[model samples]
Target: MNRAPGDGLSAGEVARRLGVAVTTLRSWHRRYGLGPDQHEAHHHRRYTRQDLSRLEVMCRLTGEGMPAADAARAALTVHPLESVERPRTGSALSARAGGGNTIPVGGAGPEARGLARAAMRLDVATMSSVITRMIGARGVVHTWDHLLRPVLAGVGERHAAGGGLVEVEHLLSRTISETFAAVPRPAGAPTPRTLLASADEEQHTLPVEALAAALAERGHRSLMLGARVPPGALAAVVGRVGPTVVVLWSQAPATAAAGQLNGLRGTPLVVAAGPGWPRDGLPPSAARPASLGEALDLTLRWLPTAG
Candidate 1:
């Protein structure tokens, strides 16, 4: 016998210590056979120390972004001390979490590792939930710089190396766009004085979107023209709306046409953002923002704070 009934812990107390709900405890029991092993005829079942240990493993793994089913399986099987993180043999999570299809999130925290695993499996709910939770906890800039960028770059590099994982890349991008676009905007915000768009024929737009979301978090508004606006079109928009500042993003050298900045020279502030811009060809009027924070700072200088 692991422990006498007198020494067993209650479900309510276990849940409180684990920072999860009692219902969650019940569900784990119903699903994964993780309920208290100690039972008596007259008294309700109570969890033993070993039970708590397994539940802790489950919670830790799930918190690190492992799916609930896999976490539960790992919880039931692994040695509490030495093998908790390693999922059981033939588990999908074991392969997906560390196998050949992994995304390289160099030196990032557990959250990034979890996010990468979820991304590789194309688990949209886990990916979205992890991203939204991180953004809510640390704000957009931190989440983007620390979490999203590494995974995105990893996926890109992997695809470039062998032209594989294109599906993973597209799914992750769409999920990011949907999540970033969901960042709440200020109510009754003034007309946007800042413009954001990708460079001509440049399809990559997530970095610019990050700047937009960061601005939104600070109660600022910007005209998000989205990806691949031709120079002439940007000029037309500038001529008509006349944004105080416009940010053009170029992710590769091929799209960083210096000519794109030429049309918007009349705009009061033209920010040539992203790595695509040529070192020597930017117009003297074009301001170069080195990071998302710098772009945000530059845009804020042109617009009043929104309520």
Candidate 2:
């Protein structure tokens, strides 16, 4: 049920609904004079519906990659009661799932559309909050295949066509990497038996990171050798650590040499994941997973004790 009009929300509640930190809320308030008007001196501020409406506009504007001060100026101009509605139960950013103006997420769900919007704005906070929430609710594997990939693919498509959104692509990659890195690896899990790495000269590491987070969700710990490991260096690590399974990812044809697979001939199982690998030349030492789920399944087969 909705609270009465006189009722007000605290800064913490406003921050939670807005998909931003309380510290960020406070910063906006201090920097832009956007704080609650209902409070008198010395008492804590309680945001009224009007205040909530203004902040909602603020979030939407800022999320479109606007300068904070300018967004605040625009938000302040919004008429009270005009934009205020029943605030959604989850993060306010979820309310923006309808905007398909900038990024082309092509027939993907509201969540994917919402994510693509955040990516275009380079709105790191909303993107990260949405991604973390989805991963927690849906598990990492499903989140990767469903939410993340669709947006990433759309970003790629847009980039390929117009040569724009370079900033969006880079920001999205960094945000995904940071979010996946935060996924909790199981405690007291056996020493990591799976090693994940990108093929030599390969700069695309997001897929590898997704597999690592997915493994973590299943109560298995895996070692990550992120991005562009030289063939000799990868071989040296394999020999020293002796992982039961190793997964190598390559995202482009230039980075997919058959020899990278050959370097790990002694490992019990090696996964040559990603489309980068040539169809015919994979050494018997490595197997290719058709998707993220398959990579997890293939790795778990080698490390049967994985939780």
What TM-score does each of the candidates earn?
0.72, 0.72
- Model 1 scores a C-alpha lDDT of 0.80
Tens digit per residue, CA lDDT, model 1, 1-307: 2334358888887766665567777767765666776567799777777888888777667656676677877887773434223323444324322234577888877788777766765667777888899999999999998989988988888888888888889888998998899999877888888899999999999998998899999998778988889999999999999899899999999898898888887788899999889888688878888888788888888877666
Residue 264, model 1: lDDT of 88
Per-residue alpha-carbon lDDT of candidate 2 for residues 112-144, written as tens digits (9 for 90 to 100): 766776776567887888788889899998888
For candidate 1, the 10 contiguous residues with the lowest summed lDDT are 79-88
C-alpha RMSD of each candidate structure in angstroms: 10.9, 10.2
lDDT of 1 at 295: 86
Candidate 1, residue 253: the lDDT equals: 95
Clash count, one per candidate: 0, 0
Best by lDDT: 1
Q: Report the C-alpha displacement of residue 76, candidate 2, in angstroms.
A: 13
